[model samples]
Target: MDIATYTAFCLTAGPLTILMVIGLWKLFEKAGRPGWESLIPVYNVYIILKISGRPWWLLLLLLIPGINIIIGVGVAVDFIKSYGKFKISQNAAIILLPFICLPKWGFDKNTRYLGPSATISFHEKHRKDLQKSTTREWAEAVIFAVVAATLIRSLFIEAYTIPTPSMESSLLVGDFLFVSKINYGARLPITPVAFPFAHHTMPIIGGKAYWNGIKLPYFRLPGLGDIKKGDVVVFNFPMDADSPFYRPVDKRENYIKRCQGTPGDTLSLLNAKVYVNDEAAITPSHGEMEYMVRNDGSSFNRQLARDLHLSDIQQFTNQDFMMNMTAQSAALLKQQAGIKSVRPNIRFNGVYDPEVFPHNPKFRWNVDNLGPIIIPKKGWTVKLDSLTLPIYRRAIEVYEQNKLQVNDNHISINGKPADSYTFKLNYYWMMGDNRHNSEDSRFWGFVPEDHIVGKALFVWMSWDAETHKIRWSRVMRMIK
Candidate 1:
C-alpha cells in the first residue's frame, strides 16, 4: 500500500457516503419547527407523517433527496391547515411565511403549531404502502452499486483499450482487455505518510526520502513457469513508470513482439529468418498478410482476412470491425498486431550455417547474429579481463558498486552471498518473431524477470476489415 492508493480508497468510500447523508437531509426540508420535528430520529417514532397531520411513514421519503423536496412542501402545507392556533394556513405558509423564517416550511425549530390529531385512519390503511416505497429504495440502491463497482474495478482488474499494430494480428485497437492486478501479486496497502521525514517523499522531492514509506506486507510471490516462449505476456513498461501518464504495462507502447530466446542459448535473426542458438526456428505460417481476426480493418488488412476465411466462413459487416484510434493509440495497436511469436523448443539448423548437427552442434555468431554467452546467475563469477563487454560491465556496476555497500567485505547480487558479487534479478532475451520488423533485446538487450505480468491466455476476438465484421468464433480460443 502507498499514499496514493489509500487516498483513492477514502475518496471513494468516506466523503461520498457523507454527501449522500446531507443530500437526504436537504430533501425532506427538516432543517427548521413542528413537522420540522421529523428530523429528530427518536421523536419521529419511525412514523413521522402524523406530526404533519398527513399519512404516517412519509419519513421513508425523507430518505430520498430529489423527491423529498416535493414531499416536504406538500407536508408543510397540510400541517399548517391542521394548525388552527396559527394564522399561517396551508397556502399562507408557502407564500407570506417566508417573511418570518427563511426556510418558510416544515423542519424549522422556532415555529410552533397546534394541529388536529387527524389521519390515524389514513395511516392504518396505507401502512403497507408506507413500508414499501420501492421507487426510493431502488434509486438509492443504484447509486450505491455504481459507486462500489467502480472502486472494485479500479483496484482489481482495470479495463484497457488496445491502440496499436505492433502487437497487431493479435490485440487490435478498440479491442477491450482486462488486466488483472493480482496476476503479478499486488502490493499491500500502506499508509502514505506514517513515520514522516524517513518516507520524506514530499511534493518537491522525489520518492526516496521516507521512513515508513510505501511498505507492503510482502505476501506470496507471483507464480513461476507460466510465461513461455510465443505466449503473449504483459509487463510494466521498463523506461517510464514514473511519467505523468501511467502508460500501459503491456510491452507494446510498453508492449512488443519478441521470440523467446532461453537462458544460456545464443539467438539471432539474419535477413528474415529466426535462429535460436544457431538453429532455425520452426514457424507457423498464418497465410498471407491480409487482415487476420477481424475483416473490417484498413486497406491493407483485407487480403489475408479473406484468405483465412477459406470461402465457407461467413462474412462480417458490423461497425465493430474497425477501430478508429488516435495516431499515438494506433501505433500501440499496430505493434500488438504485427507478429505471432513461436516458442523456441525444437532443434533445427541455422539458415546461414550449413554445417548441420544431427543431434547437437555449435557454431560462430555475427553482429546481426548472436549467442554463446552464458546466462549470468546468482553465484556466477568472472575475471574482469577474461570476459568483459559494455553490457556486462554495466550490470556489474549496478549490482556491486551502487546496490551493495559492505563494510570492508565483498558484496553479492540476488540472494547468492559471495566474495565476488554477480547477477541480481533473473534475466531473459526477447526478440520479435517477425525477424526484420522488431526492435528488441538484440538491440536494447536482456529483460529482467521481475517485470513479468502474466502469460496471454487467449485471443478473445477478431475483426475483419473487408466485411467490417467481428468474428465470434475466435473468442476464447487458446493461443498456440
Candidate 2:
C-alpha cells in the first residue's frame, strides 16, 4: 500500500472503529448490557441493532451489494435515537461524522443513554405524536435522503449521461446509463467531502465541487469480477494526470470507453483493427465506422436517416455523401434506392497524427496505426531507452508518483541512475467504438488501473437531443 492509501485507512476505518467501540461500550453499559460487547465487530452491530428497536436479522442486509448502504444509515439513525438524541444536526452528524458524534454522545457527562426504560417508550410515543416541529421533521427527512443517495451513488451504482459520441452506436450520446461500481468493486472516495449530486463542477456556478481539506486514502472493495478485454468501462481521464490542481481519482472527469488491452498484453492497431497479443480483437456487433458514400443525384431520405440514427452526414457533392455509420446502418443505406456505393473511410498506415499518445515527434503513430506497445503490469520491469521512454514516461512519473528525469543517454528515477523500472500499478488501453471520431488512448496514453471507475451496465434512458424526443426503444436496454 502507498502512503496516501495508508493515511486514508487510518483516518476513516481505524478511528471510526475505535470511536464506535468506545461509544457503544458506554451506551451498552447504560442499557444494562456488557460494555465489552461493543468491542466485538459483527456482534457489536447485532447488539446495536437490538438496542435500536430493529430486528437482528436485518444485519444480513449488510451483505447485499446495494442494499448495505441503506442498512448502514438506518442502523445509524437507530443508534442515535437509542440515546434519545433527536435533533436534526445531531442526526446529520451521526450520518456524516459518526466518529465524532458517537464518541461525543457516549463519553459526554450530560448525554445520558435513555434506552430500555419507561422514558424510552415515552420518548418514542412523543416523537410519533407530532412532538417534534414540522420543519425539523422535513429537514431530517431530507438529510437522510441525501445521505442514503450519496452512499448508493458512491458504493453501488451511479446514473451517468453520455455527453459525447465517443462510444457511438454501442453507447450513444444522450444515453443515460447506470454505471455499476460493484462489477469491478466500488472505489473508495479519495475526496470524501464534496457537494451532493454535483460531480467535479457545480451546476451554473462553474467551480470545483469538492474541497481539498481532507483527502481520504484510495481503496476498493472486493469486486464481483476483474476487468476483461472488450468490456465497456468507465474511467477517469488520464490526461488530467498532469494537472497542476489536485484532482482525486474519483473527482476527475468520467470517461466511458472499451478496454482494448489489459495489463501484460501487447496492443496494436493495424489498419483500424485492434490486435491484442497478436490476435484480432472481436469488435462489437453494432460498432460504427465512417464511410464515404455515393448516391445517384438524390438526397438521402430524412425518415430513413433518423431511423438509422445517423448524425454525422456531410455532402461533398450532389452525388457523394460522407457519413459516419454502423456496418448494419451502412448495409441498410446500400439497399436504398439511387445509392451508388458505400465504402468505409480508412486512414492509411504510416500517416502520423501529431496529437497521438506521448505526442513525441519521433513517433509517427496515428490512430489506426498505433503500437505493438506492451501495456505495463504491476511488478513488470522493462529496460528504458529513447524508444520506450516516451511511451511509459507519464505512467512512471505521474500515475506511479515518481520523480523521473531523462539525462544524457541515461534515465534517473528519484535521482538514481536506472536503466529499467518496474511499474507499481497495472495499466489499460481504452478506445471508443466510434473508431474514426474519438479522442481516446490513441490521443492520450495508457489508463492507469487507479483511474478505472466502473463497468457500464444499462441504458436506463436515452434522449434524441437533435430531434428533442425520447428514444423509447433504448429505455432499460442492457449494455452488452
lDDT against true structure, model 1:
0.42
Q: What is the TM-score of each candidate against the true structure?
A: 0.40, 0.88
Tens digits of lDDT, candidate 2, 1-480: 566667767777876788867877887887778999988888988888777767888988898766776788778876777677766677678877877877777788887666634346856578567476878779778876887788888888999999989888998889999999999998878787889998888899889898978766556888899899989999998776455745777788889999999999999998889999899999888878789999888767878888886768898899888878888998988898988999988878877778988688787788888888899999999999999999998888878778898778878998999899989788999999998878899998889888888999999999988789999999999987
Regions of model 1 farther than 4 Å from truth: 1-161, 170-226, 241-259, 263-265, 270-272, 277-281, 284-368, 372-375, 382-387, 393-421, 463-468
**Residue 393 of candidate 1: its Cα lDDT?**
45
Cα shift from native, residue 193, model 1 (Å): 10
**Cα lDDT over the full model 2:** 0.84
For all candidates, the clash counts are 56, 1
Best by TM-score: 2
The 0-to-1 C-alpha lDDT of every candidate, in the order given, reads: 0.42, 0.84
Find the 10 residues in a row with the least total lDDT in model 1.
Answer: 286-295
Tens-digit per-residue lDDT, 98-204, candidate 1 = 33332333334544444345344444666686564678568657644653454343234444444544443445434545554444443222333232322223447
Cα RMSD of all models vs. native, in order, equals: 17.9, 3.1
